[model samples]
Target chain A: MKKLINGADTVLEESLDGFAAAHADILLLGAERKFVRRRTLKPGKVGLLSGGGSGHEPLHAGFVGRGMLDAACPGQVFTSPTPDQIIEAAEAVDTGAGVLFIVKNYEGDVMNFTMAAEMTGREVASVVTNDDVAVERSTYTTGRRGVAGTLIVEKMVGAAAEIGMPLAALKALGDEINRRTRSMGVALLPCTVPAAGRPNFTLADDEMEMGVGIHGEPGRRRVRLASADAIAEELVGAILKDLAPEPGSEVLLLVNGFGATPLIELYLMVNSAKRILEGAGITAARFLTGSYVTSLDMAGVSITVSVLDGQAKELWDAPVHTAALRWGT
Target chain B: MKKLINGADTVLEESLDGFAAAHADILLLGAERKFVRRRTLKPGKVGLLSGGGSGHEPLHAGFVGRGMLDAACPGQVFTSPTPDQIIEAAEAVDTGAGVLFIVKNYEGDVMNFTMAAEMTGREVASVVTNDDVAVERSTYTTGRRGVAGTLIVEKMVGAAAEIGMPLAALKALGDEINRRTRSMGVALLPCTVPAAGRPNFTLADDEMEMGVGIHGEPGRRRVRLASADAIAEELVGAILKDLAPEPGSEVLLLVNGFGATPLIELYLMVNSAKRILEGAGITAARFLTGSYVTSLDMAGVSITVSVLDGQAKELWDAPVHTAALRWGT
Candidate 1:
């Protein structure tokens, strides 16, 4: 595989080193690389921490800063971090209020984060996200695998936590956000993991894997490539089927890239999906388009639709200062 | 040629529709998609305007908003915008303080922007960027192509314009930034222009084009793929050779992606290049990483190093709110 790394085994540490150096102004590295935490801690504010495999960057790590995650522990590519890593991160970010873990639904991630929640000594709680509607049970997950929708979950709840929400309330808020969100992805090409040195799956030039997961796992089906409008209809249709938001309800639409797709294509997808949502009498009032959650170098796109209430809409618009997502600060 | 676009013919307008919808709070689309202008234009601020082909997104259009370009005109993918479009954009953004055009050094872009400057009624000036150290004379240009370094120029000068720097002084500051910066890119795989419906060039599995242009134009040479560290050395080495910054000088380093390269690889290149800069006794004091300027779906990265004086460094850190870049609000 033609990847830009010194070696597969060292990709995580090297990239972490670069990350730490580049963003030194905003964050700090934990001892032994257990996690990355904000440089400045806020007293009595609940700590918000999340993590998973290293490949889907700007998710857990990039979301760490003023109004988002407080700490993030990154494991090797497509592998879960150990419980010890999560424990250390919790300790580093805790400000006496408590620590809240944002765990994805993958079995390894849920288990490791749960172990850390148990092992840590504090008022700790957790919110496990399973917002990917692509699968009920997948290769590495027991239920729907958390994908791009996890970004929305982290963002809205992180804003509430920043406003001094109690640990229990923050956990509840996170769960509520996750319950209202759904995502589906389509892959034009499989990503090559640094360690694997080969694509995990293959797609013919004229085919696409609909409902694809972030780690190149098998999706719902492989089908002949179609126009952006047809793909947008399928993705939004499945989401609307599951979500069933009332007519005229407002929603936030996210057109996310899976590493190798261009931003223009993501924007084009946004236009197509927004039109589809309008035709269904659902107004896509808010929008974000970019590669926030990504697989290594996969050529694909994920559509995330989140039904928003007054509180969620306000929190979503609140100021956030992270490496990946920033606004009003 | 698997892409998420409805049709190559409508890609420009469709993407612009999505972009305008996604960022309505910050920018306004001009009549018939001629340009995107800041929603609340400053009355007396020296209006900053830039534009070119549409494919290298987040460049001209994404950079439009507060503390940056007051307006950006977008043309069809990989083709220059017409002179009338530029003239109209200039008229919309120009306040009492006049307007300054930031043009990339392309044959079409330069010729068209020059025509607009001559045709406009108000006082006008420009800083034509030609910072690519890849080739002295290359395809589509009479001199070095303005690549990723153009972002640095727009940012630093945009910051100055925000503080109400006059049109003439802003043009001079932009030229100064261009003089101090140099860039080089390496493309692992060629990009397919949607309109062309084919890859612009081809490379063997184990080869890369060094110093490749943003449009997939020929670079200095094609060589066997090398490790990230070795590749970083070659790119940064060429920049250092041409720039020849003082041993103790500080710089702002930008590692930019060519649409498809992953973020981890960009950070790895950052670490590699930072170490090389330190070895040369030069300091890389500021950093930005991502695919700001891109060649639609090309899997590659470019390294841009700009020497920063005290004023330039301070301006780089100033508050600027745009769809793509935001900080310190």
Candidate 2:
């Protein structure tokens, strides 16, 4: 593999060590590497926790800090975190209000987080994110798989929780944000899991996977390569068709990159997606564009749109000081 | 070849459109697509300006904002901005305090920015960065090539300018930081220019380039691929040899990815680099790790070490509000 890993077996733990060291001011590495928690907990505020498989760096772990996640439990590459990691993270961050779990809707992830919530005595709730409309069910998930939209849910709900939102309210807000958000991805190249030492799948140079999963699962279609405008059209078309937001509604547009795609392309996708949204009479009031959610070394992009109310917009604009997303502070 | 751009001929203009739209809150797209300027210029502060080839997204343009660059001129893919574009951008952002240009040390870029500085009527100065130690003279430059260290120069000088440092002092500060900083890059895969439609260079799956440039320019040597720790030892060894920093010098460590590398690998590289620095009796006082300065889609990374004195560290810690780097704001 043309990767920079020292050992495939220790990728997660070593990377977590580096991440914690780099962002020591904002992140506290949990004992035994179960999770990375915020350095300082906000007294009386609801604790926000999230996690999932690794490989998508800067997701749950990088989002842990002020105005975002209080703790994040990371699992092995493309594998869900254990129930123990989730339970310990929830217990560590829970101060007084409660702990709210922001979990992606995968079978393993849902099972583990659900088990943790049941086992923990601390008041706990979870918003299982299933915003991918590309598939009703996938190899790894029974329902629509949560993809890039999970980051949006975490940012929005994390902001709400920062201001002492109750656990119930934070959970409700997360669900509402997840409901309004949708994402679809396309891949030009496949990524390798470190241990596998090979690309998960293969595509010809002139072909593209239309609705690929983050972990390289088969998508809705594997078609001939299309221009960026056409790809944006299909992805945004499906999203708008499913969302069907009211005419003249304002929304936040997110053009996220899968691994290996550059910022220029991500921003270009944003332009294409924005034009489509404008054509549909929706105003893209705010924008977040980058490779925050990624498939490890996969060459592609995902476009996410979240219909925003005044409140959601305010929360997104709030100060956040995480390793991945930080602004306004 | 697989990049998500509308057309190779218009990649710069279209990507600029998307970048401006995504960051409308902080960026002002320049007329005739000459540059991207800050939405709100800070009066009386030295106008910090930078420009370079377009393929390295988020280097100059993404750094244009409150505490960083006042304006950034982006050329077409891997090409330097014309003198007219640079002249126009300098005039646009130059206030009464004058403008300071932070330029990377590529021949075309240096010549164009110098010509623009001579042509522009406004008071202007420049600090050409040449922090790369891989080759004393490479395919692109007469001296060492400026790699990821350019970002550090821009950041530190930009912070100094934000606090109303005069143009002369800012230029000197930039030069000093450039003197103290050293960087070296290695590429695991070659990148394709959109117009070229193929990889710029060839590398077997088992081989790697030791010191590749940001624009696919030839580096010092190629060898069989090795582990991340061995790579880190070689790179850090060369840097410390060139720098010969004091035994206890507190330095800022930047592990920057060349486009296709993921954050996990970058952080893992950082961990390796940090261990080496500690063994050399140096303290990595601060850290900035990301795919900040990238070759379009090259899978690799560059390590930058800038020895930080009190003033430099303070300036580095100062608030910066840009699309790529934001903190303490």
Candidate 3:
């Protein structure tokens, strides 16, 4: 297998060092036993803390900025951040406003973040995002694991907090966003974690896996790679059938490229998405095309749609400042 | 030239179609235009409109939520959105509050957004973000172009607007964010645009490109592929020299991965970055790691740092809600 960098073991540390040096504006609390918030907590604002494994960038840390997360605890690659680190971050970022923990609906992330929240003596509100429509509950696991939908929950809750909305309201908004948002993803090729140094899973040149997770985890099923049109049909069909948003309802269309998918493909998919939405009598009031959230270098795409209403729409239009996302004004 | 999609021509259209169908909540303006606010614009809030090429996903669009932007115009892959499309998006999201255009400092993006902003009339505020520290002004073109620094400006301006800050303040904040921020990027391997069906550039296994642009444009220089440590040193050195934040000052650290780089690599780089910061006696008050802004599947990373003061820090701490970033409360 071909790869860049020196050795897998040193990859994480070296990269983190580089990241810190380059971005001196953000404090880096190294990956140690206790990870502290790089920034001091404001006197009144509630400190919001969220984190998980390292692979999903811009998700945990990238979201850390104004109107968003106060502190993001990053674990090792694909592994949950230890409870100690999360707890420390929670404590560090907590202001009197009370910290709201936004945890993605992943087994490890849920468990770790939950532990951190539980350990915190401060007033803590937590929301678990389970918006991936592709996964179904079978009594064994949670209904649907949070995928790209987590972005919506995080943003809504973050905005609410930034504007000094009550924690309960923020939690409710987060849950509501999750309820309205659904995501389904497909993987064209398995991504090779630098540590693993090989494809996460083997697939024929023409094979693609649907409902894949970010950690190079297996998806629901694998199928022959089909035309972008066909793939769009399947993906959109599943999302539409699952969410069943009312026709004419406004929606946020996110055509997210997994790691390696090219923009050309994403645009093509967006084109197909336009036709399908028109045919279904649905109007896409907002369209987001790009890698808002990604899975390493997975070479695939995921579709996330959030049904918006008056309140949600307002919140969606709120301005935010962060390393990864910003707008408004 | 290994790829998973069926055909190159159909990629963008199909992806968009699937995206629209999945996101019933968002209104897809069809293939001819970009996305707009799903709900009718609030009667008095100035519309915040921004757009560019399609590759930077969730950028101009994902940020179109509350506390951020009003609309985002998406163009073809790596190509700036046409003025017509931007005009339509502006019209669609405008609520008589006027519109603010947050544009990255690229030739195409600047020209296109500039044209669109001019056509929109006097109420429009256009802020161009040119935060890249890598490129130096020569006899040829404008100094450095914008990079990940655009994200920071967007968020800051978005937050100002969300809080009812006047357009003047928003514009000032955008400009300030642009001034305080700087970025530099490197590319290890060339990325492929689906329609092109080939690599945008070529790099030997032992070679890496420095100072790369977002659209797979060639960098300022090329050198032997170095270790993550070495690469980080070079990148950090340039950025630090450019910004020259105080040694003991607090700052924000952003470690951005281009498309193909894995989380493991990002983490590794982050760790390395932390060490570099320590050596400089600088602390990152905020650190973000992820593939927030990407360039297709290009295997590379960029670092951005914003020197923060009390107000900047407070604003950075404000809560926000959007597709890509969430925090606060």
Candidate 4:
């Protein structure tokens, strides 16, 4: 495999070291090596934490900062973090308000974060984001795998937390956001795991994997690759169908790159998604397009559509100062 | 050959459609399909105009928004925009304060922008960024190719312009940032130009090209692939040698990804670059990491180091809202 890593084992440590140093003002190494917490604790505020496997970057870790996540515990690539790591992170950021865990709908992630919440001995609430409408059951997930919508949840909830919202409110907010969001993706190429030294799966030069998961989980099926507009139509069609927003409903559209896709392609997909949304009479009130969440080196794109409620737009537009998502502040 | 384009011929138009739609609040399509301009032109302000080939995204176009370029003209992939297109963009945004053109050192880019400046009839000053220390001469370039350092120039000068710096002053600032900056890059694989429908160059499975250009221009040389740390040491060592700052110099480091490199790899390189700089006794006062400027889908990373003066730091830290870069707004 043509990968740029010192060693497979050292990739996580070295990456986190670089991450911590780059955002020294916002993020710090926690008491343990597996997690990172906000550099300063805002007294009397609820702490927010979200994490899972490591490969999907700019997710839990990159989202840690003011107006976003408080702490993140990244496991090895595609593996869940231990409960101890989450427990330590929970304890590190917990203030008088309480702690909220935004866990994905994956089996291992739910189990570990649940265990950590029990061990923290602090008032805690948890919300599971199962916004991926790609598949009902996947290799690592029970119902659906949480994907790009996690970013939406983290941003809105983090903003609510920043305003001193209590833990239960934040938890309910996360749940409602997830309930109104849907995402689907397609991969033109498989990503190689550094340790595996081979691609997770092989695709013919003209083939693509539809509804691919973040960690290379099996998608709906493979098909001949099509044009950007066609692909965008398929992905957005699936997401919009699952979402079924009322006509004229305002929604926040996010077109996320599955690592390795160029900005041009992502922009093209965004255009197609917007066109499709407009035809269906759903207004794209606001939109985000980039590699916000990614599977390592996979060339693909994911479309996420979330119906914006009374406060969803406000929270999303609120100031967020994080390594990945930043605005206003 | 796996790409998400409708047709190679329509790539530019479709991508721009998406780009303009996604940032409708800030960006708009010019009368001609060849350029994108700010939605609200700031009358009496010194306008900034930049344009070149279309492939290097978030470079010229993405930088168009408040506090950045007033207009960006996009040509076909890997092709220089026409003088007419540049002239239109220049005229549209030109105010009594005049307009400044930021052009890369590529022969076509320089020649065309110079012609546009002459045709605009408005007072126009131009700065050619030649921060690539890769080679003295290469394909499509005579002296040195402008690489990621163009970003530093645009950002610093854009900030200065926002505060009412005149065209000449902005030109001088762009020149200064270019002079104080140096960059180098390496590519593990070749990128395919959409129009070409094939890889730009060939590399053995275990080989890498050092000093690769953003447009698939031949780099310094190729060698057997090495560990990420070793590669980072080589790239950082070369940039520092070219930039030969004082032992105690405070510098701003930018680690940019060529289209397809993963964040994990980029962060690993960032860590390695930091370590090497520390070993040299230079302090990295601040840093930015992401695929800010990119070649289409080249799997590589570019390292840029700029000596941060008081003014440079202030401008870099200045609040600017663009589709690509934003902070402290």
Q: Best candidate, lDDT-wise?
A: 1
Model 4 TM-score, 2 decimals: 0.99
Candidate 1 vs 2: which has more lDDT: 1
Off by over 4 Å in 3: A1-6, A12-186, A193-224, A232-258, A262-296, A301-329, B1-31, B38-40, B93-97, B137-141
TM-score of chain B of 4: 0.98
* Top DockQ hit: 4
Q: What CA root-mean-square deviation does each model show from the true structure? A: 1.0, 0.9, 7.8, 1.0
lDDT of 1 at B77: 89
DockQ score of each predicted structure, in the order shown: 0.80, 0.81, 0.23, 0.85
Q: Candidate 1, what DockQ?
A: 0.80
Residue range with the least summed lDDT across 10 consecutive positions in model 2 chain B = B5-14
For B1-329, candidate 3 gives per-residue lDDT tens digits of: 55545576654444444444433453344336455453434567767777777666546555665566767777777778888888778787766777888887667777877887788774788888888777665222266777787877777777777677767767888888888888888898887787887898998877888888877666678988778777778788888888888889777778887767765577677766666766888777777776667786788988888888887777766765555566652
Give a tens-digit lDDT track for model 4, residues B182-275. 9999999889998899999999999999999998788889999999889988888988888899998889999999999999888888899999
Pairs of colliding residues, candidate 1: none
Model 4 score (lDDT): 0.91
TM-score of the A-chain for all models: 0.99, 0.99, 0.92, 0.98
Docking class of 2: high
Q: Which run of 10 residues does model 4 chain A get worst, by summed lDDT?
A: A29-38
Over B69-162, each residue of candidate 2 has an lDDT whose tens digit, in order, gives 9999999898899999999998889878888988899999999999999988789999999999999888779999988999889988888888
Instruction: Show where candidate 2 strays beyond 4 Å.
Output: none
State the TM-score for model 3: 0.66
Residue A287 displacement (Å), model 4: 0.6
Colliding pairs, model 2: A329-B329
Interface DockQ of candidate 2 = 0.81
